[model samples]
Target chain A: MQSPTRAKKKTKATSMDIAHRAGVSQATVSRVLRGSPLVNAETRRRVEEAVKELNYKVDRHASSLRTQRSGTLALLLFEDPTPDDSHINPFFLSMLGSITRACARHGHDLLVSFQQLSDDWHADYEDSMKADGLILLGYGDYLAYESKLAHLVAQGTHFVRWGPVLQGQPGISIGCDNAEGGALAGRHLVAQGRKKVAFLGDASTHFPEFFARYCGCDAALREVGLRMNPALQVDADSTEQAGYEAAQVLIARGLPFDAIFAASDLIALGAMHALKEAGLRIPEDVAVVGFDGTPMARFSNPPLSTVVQDTSKAGELLVDTLLQLVRDQPAQSITMAPTLQVRASSGG
Target chain B: MQSPTRAKKKTKATSMDIAHRAGVSQATVSRVLRGSPLVNAETRRRVEEAVKELNYKVDRHASSLRTQRSGTLALLLFEDPTPDDSHINPFFLSMLGSITRACARHGHDLLVSFQQLSDDWHADYEDSMKADGLILLGYGDYLAYESKLAHLVAQGTHFVRWGPVLQGQPGISIGCDNAEGGALAGRHLVAQGRKKVAFLGDASTHFPEFFARYCGCDAALREVGLRMNPALQVDADSTEQAGYEAAQVLIARGLPFDAIFAASDLIALGAMHALKEAGLRIPEDVAVVGFDGTPMARFSNPPLSTVVQDTSKAGELLVDTLLQLVRDQPAQSITMAPTLQVRASSGG
Candidate 1:
């Protein structure tokens, strides 16, 4: 099975060489490589060994052309540039890592791209036939890109999105229970005997995930016969810089708030930075809580208290669901539960 | 140039339709799409307009069937499983981000995968012709994988590695000045009036990057009539858990070290955690510095001081160099400089 020296002698091995090495006919080698049921088990194994030893690729283009299945998945990440220059939100990077691993586990390849919000990426990916299906991951306005998703659905493209699993969405999705995550943060803060909580993130319909989180926090606050102050809430994107700026704006409003819940971990980190710069101590002054339990959250200055979205599970499900759609299996939208990680920042 | 509605009316558009829309013969459209110099700029623009508006892919597999180039790049990230299960080093994730962007800038698609160190990934990518070239990124024993690089070279596989730019390596590489990075950490600690500086990472040829960093730091210490104590160095991988365990070992050794320099940011982060757990105050009890100016360092407890490698430039160089090789252009192994980011962790 392992013949490194043989592979080196020939720059590119043809099917004839594979057939010769396997002690089989070229037709048998083709049958084995093409996953035909006509080939016997022992003969298929032998042909595969020969293919490996000879470093033969079986002309992926020709194979894909015949089957119309490229055995590849395209991951189109809508670029959300941050001040840190990572170009991808750290939370999304973790997702990307998991998704890549899951693809390997499922025996598929992944084609990754950082796309602008305005690109006609959905149609292009399907039309190009570069992949069997698509996995959409990013941070941006849901409304802004919803039309593109509708277009994808209209054209019958197989795609799964990573965001809030909303009703009437054009495509299938795998998402965290943002409301449950926010409620957990709020209830934790509420149990700490805190009131007048401020939220940092856009709570508009454009960003439904953040909006759901806002509503969930409000519901938790309502449990204590209280409601989130509209004036205390400042709209911010899912970025540290935006979180910092939103915090500054909240501070400038001269409103008294005891606890702050950021829509995402990055926003929480930035808000914490601003709070510290303004001489506000963590937990004692403002009990700060963030979303997304990324590794970065665990190592923050006060070990940020965050709503840990199950990214590992999310990645697996995203791949699984997309593959289901690709194989014409009945795949449905999935929503995973979120949990709270109490740490120093939230008075743990 | 853009016509979304018409594209939706038809599920798939053909070359004949593009020719008709461009007001040219199918031959002219084919020449223009194939990028033959025989087609003029105005005709090319008109045909391209038709292609985009109609959302015709031109069948990537069929096109590559005629021409050898796949117009795709494969990024094989050797999985370095961290305790957090992200499966990729955060530093490498940054490089991945930049590399993905660079591929987009260069008009090439990117195929990403998490490969095991022992897998025949190098040969598979080349043999499959799934990508025009390969970009290999990961962290492990250099000697363990050096033979694999040699195998790739022997097979005339087009590849660029991300690691130490050794003078006589089998394939081309784009790397950071690791020794200089180590020197930066040593000099900074020295400037803080620290005499005893410990190092965390493997200091052997097996891990050339870490070994070079160890050597660089030792060299810097020697300039001030001092040398790194052999007892103070601990062997560890580039993971937070590894760092933590290494630091615990160092603490148990009772080596009177006043400072510590980790080989990577993950190690520093883990070491910092262990140090804090053992009732040691950062910068005061033991000044600590790390390499890899990842964003995680910027938000860590006491804001970890770290050596910064120019990953964006490295990404650009890796892609540019690989494309050069793919195009039969001259490519060379390039080394980039490193800088230090001073933070409170190192008493900055």
Candidate 2:
């Protein structure tokens, strides 16, 4: 006599259900589902497992459409400042890779546009589609783009400036602890018992990276009761050839610095070439240390000692910071610690 | 007043208009727009110019939807390979770069997947999506996921294979003319009166590259009236360390090779390093030539003489070929010509 009709079981888990299960807000559950790093990994993994078990499928496009948002991000890189060897600062390269990977894991993709200072420049085609956010790389002279970014921000566009931000701009940035890295390098050299030390840097300004390294080195030397030998500190053209010439000039002047700190690994490697050619033994005759530990640092004849920036993590952080801004959340400016990888040349 | 109505304006330009302007057929216009190489360069350029001038946007997404096809292409690369340095094969790197660029230019983005053979793993995401086509990097005998590819193909997913096809399937391949490159090296050495010529390469089977190069060298040596020297040939692991060790082995054997041709640039560069360490005079005692012509080729000391393959062009071609296959159109295999870049290392 009982009716055969039984309640149909629920088909799939929804965001609210996942949220309740994970003991987090629905927004946090959504963020976890979207692979946004704003949520801690433990929470995210739990949410993801729940999603898989529940066989939940979120219609991202529909939600984004309702909000009139494209759910897409644009990566704008300055093609003009591309170094001579097309050696994009490993920092940017690693950052781009991380950002792209992060975006992909979140079921989104980046529309990349490279702009150069050359003639025939135009706004990126995707500009009309209006991306949800932007990851700006080396967009020098933020003043020129201030109105552009301000307009987007007013329109609810979220973005993170991956490179240095201009003063007075309401934005977020993630960069390396350049000053600390510099200080680490300086202290390493000073600790090696080099009473006389020189600083060789590339021709760069405005980039917090170079300056931070310089300042760190400066402070460390001051703490160690030593100052940069004015006669020995020089700015090279930032090429291997330039480093060679700088070393040659230093050697020619008979500057008796027992140690040197170069701003870039390329320059340090180049300086090493020059020093070796001049019959000077590395670390023994003149201890040399470089910043930005590239793969080349290890393979060098005696190996190079340098400060390493976690480029991939920097990239991930840059994207994470940008996404936070996109979601109308606050983002703290972050500076990553530099890793000291000591090799033969740095007397480690 | 009754005749005041204006004729309805055309909403879009048809393929006919593009073909007419480009002096080709509607079919040709479609092919050109799809990046088919069958169209002559001038014709393709005309069609492209017309498409740009008209601001014609090919809604590839909508078209894929209409055709009930997945518009995405899969680019499968080894996540990691032995002699990790081999990953720097400029040819493959260039091809990857080109394919990515081409896909973007054509309003498509590649779904890149890493296949590590040791894991015997398959990509479930790509398989479920049934990618429109695949552009695979020819490396090792990683087991093939044929059932997956077959399933997609059965579902009307047209596909194009790059590099050598597996099991002699009717696959289209685009690669550098390695044999020709090899012959060029052989002839150059013979012309310089090198009686003994050594060939350094990696694995024999996976190295279709080495085979191609060897073919060219064999031809060149025959033309130069020189016999092959089996004693001078060595197949080493393709790594800097391997090259270094191979060089030592070659020298210890006291084989009189006046010239050497390494299968890849890394091998050549490594060999050069070892030779330099051994105090052998380059070009005088052992002129060296390298294959693949990676960008690093130009930067090597003595500026390594190499056969340069235009990686960007290769990238463009790979995309073009894949698009053709995606459209259910006939695709042709292509060989990119490798040009000999004469540098000091080969004594040229």
Which of the numbered candidates is closest to the native, going by highest TM-score? Answer: 1
lDDT of 1 by residue, B155-186 (tens): 87888899988867788888998999889888
Task: Compose the digit string of candidate 1's lDDT tens values, residues A52-143.
Answer: 77768877787776677789999998864433545468888889999988999999989999888878687787677788889999878788
User: What tens-digit string does per-residue lDDT give for candidate 2 at A1-348?
Assistant: 111122232333568877877778899987876668798988888888777666555643334434545556677666544454334444344455556656765655565545553422222322333355677765343445556555444434455666443344444566667788888988888888877877776424534556667878878989967776678777764456667778888888986889888877777878988998999998899998887766556556567898987666766787777677656556676757888889889777
Instruction: Please give the range of 10 consecutive residues that has the lowest summed lDDT in model 2 chain B.
Output: B1-10
lDDT of 2 at B315: 71
Question: Which residue pairs collide in model 1, if any?
Answer: none
TM-score of chain A of each: 0.93, 0.70
Going through the candidates in order, their DockQ values are 0.43, 0.05
Q: Which docking band does candidate 2 fall into?
A: incorrect
**Clash number by candidate, in order:** 0, 5
